[model samples]
Every structure is written in C-alpha cells, then in structure tokens.
Target: MRELTRDDVNAAVKGGSVFASGGGGWVDHGLEIGHAALSIGRPKLLSVDELPDDAIILTCTAIGAPAGRDWQMLGKDYIKAVQLIIENYDGKIAGVMTPQNGMSSTINGWLPAAALGLAVIDATGDIRAHPTGKMGSLGLASSIDYETIQAVAGGKPEIGSYMELVVKGTPARTSNILRTASDMAGGFIAAARHPLPIKHIKKHAAIGGISIAIELGRVIMEAEPDGPEAVLEAVVHKTNGRILGRGTVTTKNVHYSGAFDVGTIEVSIPNRRLTLHVMNEYMAVGDDEGTRLTTFPDVITTFDLKKGLPVSVGDVEEGMEIAVFAIDKSKVPLSSSVKDPTVYPEVEEMLGIDLQSYAFDKEKTIYA
Candidate 1:
C-alpha cells in the first residue's frame, strides 16, 4: 500500500479523463475530492499486475445528472454506492476500476480499491467527461439505449428509482436513474457493475492513468507559485501535451438545466483565439479559423486567471480568465466495452477512427 499524493490524483484525472470524449464527469472535481479523501486517510494505488488471476475487477462508475457534483459526494454516500454494487452482484470484489474519467466515477475507482484492500486498475471509458449516463459509454456502445441502464444513489435511505429508459431491456434504466438519484440527493452514484478478473485488465483498459494524473497535478502545483507560462510549460513538458492556444476567456454563455451547466467559452489572446462548446461537460473545442483544436476523449482543461489551480466546470462564469490545455493522447481504450458493440457504439466507432488520422501518436503529443 502507498500514499496517494495530489500529483497522482491530478495526473490520473487529467490523463484518463481526456479519453472521456466529453463524457466522464469532470477532471477538477475528481482531483479535488479524491485528494481530500487521501488527506483524511492515505488512499492506496493498487497495480492490476499484483492482483490474483481469479480476482474480480469491477469498474465502479458514477451515474448522475451534474458532472461536477463532487462537493455533494461526501461521507458514507460513496460507500453506500459500493455496497449497492456488491449487494446486487454475486461476484466477489477483488479490484476496482472506472468507466468515466471524471470525479463521480473515478473516485470510487481508486477509493473502493484502497478502502477495501483491492487492486484499482488504471482503466476507464470516456477520457475527459461526458454528460450521458454510464450505459452511453464505449462500454455500452450506443447499442444499449442510454435509458435502459441503471442509476443508483444513497440519499434518504439509499434510495433507488427506475424509469422506462427502454421499452425492452433493463427498462426503468437503473443506470439513468442513478444520475437522477444523485441530483435529488445532491451528489453522484457508482456504476459499471459488471465485474471482471485481473486477467481481463491486461487484455483491456487503460494501463496507467494514475501516474498521468499525478504528473498533471505536479505541473499545476509547480505553476501555481510561478506563472501560467511556467505551468503551461510544466504541463507540456511533463505530459508531452500541447498548449493549443492561450488567451483570456472573452465570452461565456452558461445555463443550468438537467444537472448540466451547458455553455460556450471563447478565449482571445493577441491575434489568436479559440471557442469551446460545453454541455454538462466541455464538449467541442475549436478556433475561429475553423481549425478544431480538439476531439472527443482528449480532455480540454480550463483554469482561473489569478489562481493557477483548476476551476470546477460549475464555477466557470463569463469573462473568467483561463488557460485551456489538451491532455496527452495516451488515453485508455474502450476495449472492455468494445466486445459489446451493441452497447458501445461510440467506443467502437472511435476505435475505428485510427488516432494516426488525427496526427496524435501512441507515445504523446505536446505543442504550444
């Protein structure tokens, strides 16, 4: 067992989440609360390689309305979600993993593993953050109607409700229900209940996201005392990512609906500029010249002007000075879900896209 640091949390959050393709919850929320959990008690990072071949590796994901509800995810609510998963399934929990890259899902990824003495494999679905429920992931492929999945929450007596997300299959869609449960309870619920043994981890899943979050956090910490330039350089150097463009947020359009803080952000620096379309999470990022700077699965992180720390997606307002950086393309693959194309169309479609077409190699890509 080892103590997790702010760096480890940040690196994993930033690195894994970018693969979310605008789905995972949010990067900042995960890093902040996950760090808090560690501060209270050292959170352990388990290597999948260490687990027994027969160990069951369950991907604990979060199904929720708002992607940035980490603040409300306190105390036993997290554990309750875990309990639900364990209780619902007959398999023994030997390890933990994440479906989405953001806070709601990833926290339990590392948390359940450390708290329960289980290996936490560094694998996930969406790299950045996405608004759709867990079933919408590459894991489900668009095959499973997003509504048919399950949604769970630990509010007011571990409440659960079902909706007819699908006329057939797991109707009431417990997956989507989880998100609503979190909204009603003021937090998020755990998901990706299907369990797999350690052997499947090596065969699928992103191998090393925890280390990436750590490195990303280190860059932020180093830049906090220095300057944005220093932080920018740190991120670029450490992750081998790129500073697509740097400028002040000139315009911000925000609205609150259905647990999502959807909006648009425009950043202007000197003669260059960029614009980001954000749903509950940051979606498409492009520039005025029609040059789309980023694609799905690669997280686009934004920071405040004064403090170098990351700003939560909920707190982002109009005229907020910020810096947007693209995370390394070393994103975790959706292979686990890839097997079930009916549910994981997004994962399969993107899998066929070939990263080489995007000019991002397997190693890393960093440009300023």
Candidate 2:
C-alpha cells in the first residue's frame, strides 16, 4: 500500500474538492476542523486489494444540509447520525468505508478515519456524490442490505426523523430518510449509506479527501493576503478544473423569507461586473456583458478575494467583500436531486424571465 503523508492528504482534499460540486459543502471549514483527531493516530493508507472479503464493516458520513454545514450545524450531527446507525446494527464493525466524491462526500467519508479510530478503506461504492443512497449503483448491488430505521427531531411523522429500512427495502427507505433527515436539520443531511463490502470500498472512493481538506485549509491559512489566487491555482490545476471567475460582491440584495437566505450578489472586478443569485447554495452567475453561468451537476462557490477562503450560504451577509468562483461539476458528480432544476434554475430562468425555460442541467452542475 502507498503511504501518504499528512501534507499529501491536505493537497488531495484541496485539489480533489474543487470537483466537489457546490453540494459537497465547503472543503475549507471541514479541513479546518479535521486532523486534530486524525493526527492522534498516524492514519495509514489501507489498500483495497489487501482487504479481506469477510471483514465486517460499518459505514459513516458527515450528515447535514450543505446550507447548514457552513453555519456549523454539521459537526455533532455527522458523528451522532452514524453512531445511531451503527448502534442499530447488531453486528460488529470490522472496518469502515466512504460513500464517494464531492466535498460533502469526501469530508463525510474520511472524517471517521480519525474520530472512529478505524482503518480508512481506500475506496467507496460510488465514485461521486449522490443525494440519496438509493440512487447509487451500489444500492442495487448485492452484499449490502438496506434495512434501516429513521428518526427526526420533529415535524411530519411520515417524513420520519429517522427511517427504518428492511433488507428488502433498505435502498429506497434510506433514500427517503436521507432527504427527510437533512431537511429536519434545516434542508440538508449527512448519512453513511450503501455499506459496501470492505473490499469494494477500496475500489472506488477517492481516498484522502479528509487529508486534502486539511492540507488545503492549511495552505489557505498559511498564505496571507494575495493567497486566494495561489490557493485557487493549486486546487484548480490539481483537480483539472478552471477558475470560473473572481470578483468582489459590490452589492448584496438580501431578503429573508421562511428558512431560506435569499439574495443576489453584484460583484465588480477591474474589467467587468458579475451578478450571482443565491438560495441555500449559490444558484447562478451572470455578467452585465451577457455571460450567464448556471451550475447543476457542477458547483458554484463564493470566497474572499484577498484570502481565498469560502463561506456558507446560511452565513452570507451583505457587503461581506468576497470573490465568487464556479467549479465545473463534470469532475465531481453529485445526484440529480441535488443538481436538478430545483437546486438553482435561476441562472437561466431568473435571468430569462421564465422558470421552466431553464431546466436543471444534469450534465454535472454545482452552485455556491
């Protein structure tokens, strides 16, 4: 097995997450909070090829709304949710596995490496992020059973806080519970789904996302002003992506209605000005010159112009002074529910004056 250093993990998270599609949540924050536990044990790169078939495994992931994740609603929820799920199973956990790609999935999958004191499997079932466990090809695969139980903090019982999925219906039930639980925590959730055979996990998950986040975070932190561009350059090139645009928010037209943080960000650069519409996650980006950018199956994120760090949708404030960038989703694939029209059709529709006219761009999209 290849032995990856601490710094290598950081580079990978920073670089790997550029592909996270905005739905992966922010890699910066998670990176900042990670490693304290991981540093405890010199985590090893356990190879999938070396894993045994009979090894009992437990699955865990960071669960919460991406929208809430930025606001610090995800920490305890990730550990608690997985602890509860593992508790439900009467079997012993021989090892662990991650779900797949995206900043959210990467962070969720790897967080356990340090906290649980378990060996990190090299791969996961799906290669990218999917909103619900039912959607992954693994949900249909043999070996992993879906029997589940759901619990919610409150609200409609049909939308159980947590759901119970039987072996025959584990896949569908988990999918339903995944959305329901996330919404309960304020429209997002983290879940360890489709527990793969220990060996299979070694075959798919983009290993080292946790380490990448930490490394990326440290790089951003170590670099002072004028660092955003360098951090962006390192991440973009490492992930094989391009920087969509970088500009400051000149105006933030924010209005609060219900549980949503709704608004528009008008940004200005030396040469041009751009506008971004946000709801939960950033929906769309456009320029007065008519360069309209929509994210679906791709991610859109806003960051500090001088610092190159990211902030969440729930925490956005007016005139915060920031730079906005769009990451292509074709790199880190999420689910249709997440990348669908409902996530952010405004880039096309709001700009076009018609909603349905801008269908969800399922070809790999993400938004800030």
Deviating ranges (above 4 Å) for candidate 1:
1-43, 65-71, 103-106, 134-138, 142-151, 156-174, 190-192, 328-368
List where candidate 2 sits over 4 angstroms from the true fold. Answer: 1-33, 39-43, 53-59, 66-80, 90-92, 97-105, 109-117, 123-172, 182-190, 198-226, 250-294, 327-368
Q: What Cα-based lDDT does every candidate model obtain?
A: 0.54, 0.48
* lDDT (Cα, tens digit) per residue for candidate 2, span 1-368: 44445564565455334434334455664465345435544445565556687565555554344434222334445555556556665665555555544444554534555556556565544443433343233334222454544322222234444332223235554455554455554454445544446544443344443444445545554553556677666555544555566655577675443323356777776688777665434556766776556543345666655556555554445566665656554564333233233322333343333223333433322222
**Residue lDDT tens for model 1, 1-368:** 45566657765565444334334556555765677666656666676677777887665666554543432444344545555657666568776666555543456566655455555665554434556544334344343443222324344434442221111134225444544655555444444454556776666555554554555555556665787567657666765666666567778775654455566777886687787766666655667776656644456667565765445556566677777767644443334442333443432242233223233343333233
Query: Which 10 consecutive positions of candidate 2 have the poorest summed lDDT?
Result: 150-159
Clashes of each: 46, 47
Candidate 1 vs. true structure, TM-score: 0.72
How far does residue 87 in candidate 2 sit from its true spot (Å)?
3.5
Q: Report the Cα lDDT for residue 346, model 2.
A: 30
